[model samples]
Target chain A: MASSIRDELLKVLIEHQPHFLSGEEISRRVGCSRAAIWKHIEELRHEGYEIEAKPRNGYRLVYRPDRVAPEELAPHLQTKRFGRHIRYEYSTPSTQTLAHQWAREGAPEGAVVIAEEQVQGKGRMGRTWHSPPQTGVWMSLILRPPISLAEASQLTLLASVGVQQGIKRVTGLPIQIKWPNDLLIHGKKVCGILTELRGEQDQIHYMIIGIGINVNTTSEHWPEELKKIATSLAIESGGHLHRATLIAAILKELEEVYQEYLNSGFRVIKSKWEQAAGMLGKTITARTPQGLITGVAERLNESGALLIRTDQGVIPVYSADIDWKEI
Target chain B: MASSIRDELLKVLIEHQPHFLSGEEISRRVGCSRAAIWKHIEELRHEGYEIEAKPRNGYRLVYRPDRVAPEELAPHLQTKRFGRHIRYEYSTPSTQTLAHQWAREGAPEGAVVIAEEQVQGKGRMGRTWHSPPQTGVWMSLILRPPISLAEASQLTLLASVGVQQGIKRVTGLPIQIKWPNDLLIHGKKVCGILTELRGEQDQIHYMIIGIGINVNTTSEHWPEELKKIATSLAIESGGHLHRATLIAAILKELEEVYQEYLNSGFRVIKSKWEQAAGMLGKTITARTPQGLITGVAERLNESGALLIRTDQGVIPVYSADIDWKEI
Candidate 1:
């Protein structure tokens, strides 16, 4: 297959990076003709990879692109199939839009849409997200889960746990998962998870879990309004991170958590999340459209709804903007 | 606007149906040019209505198609904007798909999509619906309700109440909303509802509520296997029913109920539904993926989950396939 030939050529280039190989040498190494090597090189160039070709020398990897490519990142990935079918976009309005379209068009499970820049990325409540070019991980994954919408909220908690674990694994920075869907680092938000679904009353057709992490972005990249409440991996680690590796790790962890969630209930994920849950047993004020409700964060119920024990009663809050009290 | 022009032309045609009118006469009646009349007629024809025009005699109404056209149905509708903006299609894969797309594309709050037939119409549990041409109401409404996903099941009940009220208003047939999402007449299904949503943790962007009703279908038109379980309005009413009028009534009732629901809680709708509920205090068996639960259907909780008093306790059933013991 043409894909296999291209894969072989990519393997050779990756192995002999920073070195120039003649066309004849590459062809011989990949067990293909020099013309085939040239074709694959052209294709790689079209894919935003920088492969320099000289007259006598075959090809040299002058610059390696930081993209979520299976060939480049699969060796570092631990799980299967989650990040295997990735679609990289240089600029898109929204990764959630692309993922939903792909899911409707029968894209395989574990399909991902990653964009280097988003012109109109969104957060919860129709808020505009700050996704600068090549400074963060803005990705969405298509998940085909056999669950009801009532149980769908668990996916948000699961994704938060995975993102927390991934960030911990990459930069050794401790992170906490806020009650519903925020990844907090040093008491500031470092990532947000938006889970959306399309399904009937009893069956879910597909769900798109979108994640936006401020990786490699400096505090200066954030707007003045968000500087106090937002943090990034680069700012925490005092160095820039490899976006491709971090994304691969996040996808792998997400796949693992997703499988665990499907096999077992949210018990495992919930246990891990509870360990990193910083707001449990603390008094907090949640501002809902109905009104503000101040209560102690009791625990998460079986369906992933936040249980708040107030003076009135134990109210299962489906969604609210939380404001924690000073510890 | 061109749409207003088309509305005017539609008004003229409906007012003077079954009679041939010269282009000049139509232009004079609507104060528009003959060329504008011809263009509006073309647009209406493209919207699935049948209009025959002769060179000199004029345009004759060959078929007054039963479709949910904004202009044709708006005058008869009593709603406050819900279903006021209509998009009619002769054939579509599914109205819900189109409605979802429109909702994502920032369509208005009360936008609706109606189709004469759906090639890939789907019901709950991945079942293919029987939506033959001009035989059913394949309609989907875009609703932006201020509710969480956990509370969305109530919307299905609200829609069922509205549908039952509409059918009662038009045909005087007493119908019941089978728990969760079906409209039944005389122990057989006449309509099915599918509600889907797209949103994040703390906010709901939009929801598409799809309704499929067997309106003018005959026994022979249904699949042989479905004949025992499905019935149409014509079958029950002992006469032919106009699809456009029925759709308009449904939308009008839906708008009223939706407005009340947004203004208040589900108290009004739930009380109305409880009066027509056929399964209350009845022994029922629900087959869920977890296990089969046998209990007496006591009531519905505030969140719209079915409360079944089983031997263990009062089990709150969120999603299940139910079977009536007497049926």
Candidate 2:
């Protein structure tokens, strides 16, 4: 909450850039004390903002920070509802846990929970997601779509396309969706998404979509186990990318695709997802809960389960770890 | 929780029935003070238990209460897990709400939430269920089933059969399931079951099966709107029924069916449910969310959705209100 107030103060300082604004005047503009303005200025400087300060001439903003603070991201967020209720945290265990609680407490659709770092980040099947501080876009979106529980898997597929397109639009990165919800660049994972739903009988109450992206994280920052299998935007693109811009782009893409899905149905989103799916027409081995099964990746049905054609016939794989070593 | 402690004192008094037991003896057995034991005896008397107190001869139990207290129910509850961790409430808004929270907090499977009365009882599709004080079995069972989200509807059907057999065994009244989750006796609704699920993309975290039975409620106990459609075991059988015994019997039936459903599959439960389904091979008017659809109720599919053979095709109806007036 204090961070949000500081962000508002920073915004006021940025709006009065190139002209020196007095501490009292900036405090009046942002509705805080002069001491608060001074403190926020120091915090902004720590956040990489360059401010020109004089003894009596007040402060003048020289440069803005590249962080994904609320003041920086809210203006660029194009969605009508998505990302409107943003809960920004510098560090947290998991946004999915908070978002689930919010959904139970009747948080409106499109509320977002984003964090700079995660202490106990989780992936699907109880796996760990390495989230370094201030280097990735770790976020979760709370959705209350009026879809059946049977069709919830499609939303995971839909979110992959959203992230894929958002990255393509911002960084021109050639990202491919790995079957269900993992995004890959140059055959290594760059992002992962986990979708969870709460429902009654056949009706879905709400869903939480948690997306973790390795944005500006360096290879050396990765743990020894994750260094080989995971790649970041900085590693793949040969440069660092703006996290705020990428987050805004992804939320916009999700809102648009979601609106289309609600209006015209899942046919359009399914086609878009299939086009970006990487494992189609390839022979892969799926490590399912039952056992390992090798089959050709045929297509994704309407419910978003992968159709794998093996010697025993066509089997629908709802969930499995795919081994694409032959590729 | 206080009610449970008082119930423990009541159990101790009942165990020493016909013998005058001192307050000190009861307190030592229940691990409370003698004054607390006296207060619990007064509370139990207020709950309709008959007790006789003498100046120096101590106290003797004269009669047992007709209520479904924990002590009364636990002795009759024979299941291994179901009703083992019972949360008994004298009055609550709804057991379903409490059971949902308990499930979210990692409550074990088969943990039961039973209430004597509901101030704001809910039925299927946002309807109000009339739950009179101390006259009905209002309870919710928390189940952590190993099943897909698509198969959640089957648990509702399975619950219907449990309620059906339990009512049959206790009341000897011929009860039949009304297509999905409602149980009807003598062409009037006697019980209603609502099933809610929490899940991931394809995995079920837990499910809550809430059942409201008009066990001993009299005709005069119902509100004006429900008097015409609702009937109770007491009214139909011309005698009051024991709610604790009925509750234990239903939980035991649910445990057995659920165990079979998890092991041998839904085949046995489906057959049992079909045998007790009242609308089979009969044309029924269903008020579905999409619209009204009249058709002959065929067999239930593996997911427990009613497969109705309409004029167009065989459509699976997951949830709806069925009218059997034509039959």
Worst 10 residues of 1 chain B by lDDT: B1-10
Candidate 1 residue-wise lDDT, A1-327, digit = tens: 124777778778877988998888888888998888888788889878899878876688776676655566654656677876777788999999899889989988888888988899978777888998889999998898877777677788898988888888888887887878888887898898888877766777898889999998887787899999999988888997888789878887898898999899879988888887889999998888888989999888766778889999998887788889553
Please report the candidate that would top TM-score against the real structure.
2
Tell me the deviation in Å of residue B203 in model 2. Answer: 3.2
TM-score of chain B of each: 0.87, 0.87
DockQ each candidate and list the results. Answer: 0.43, 0.31
State in Å the error of residue A289, model 2: 3.6
Q: On residues B227-301, what C-alpha lDDT tens digit does candidate 1 reach at each position?
A: 998998889998888888898899889988888998998899888888878888999999888899999999887
What is the fnat of model 1 with respect to the true interface contacts? 0.63
Q: Name the top DockQ candidate.
A: 1
| Model 1 iRMS | 1.9
Which pairs, if any, clash in model 2?
Answer: none
lDDT (Cα, tens digit) per residue for candidate 2, span A279-305: 899999987766798989998875677
Q: If scored against the real structure, what TM-score would every candidate get? A: 0.81, 0.82
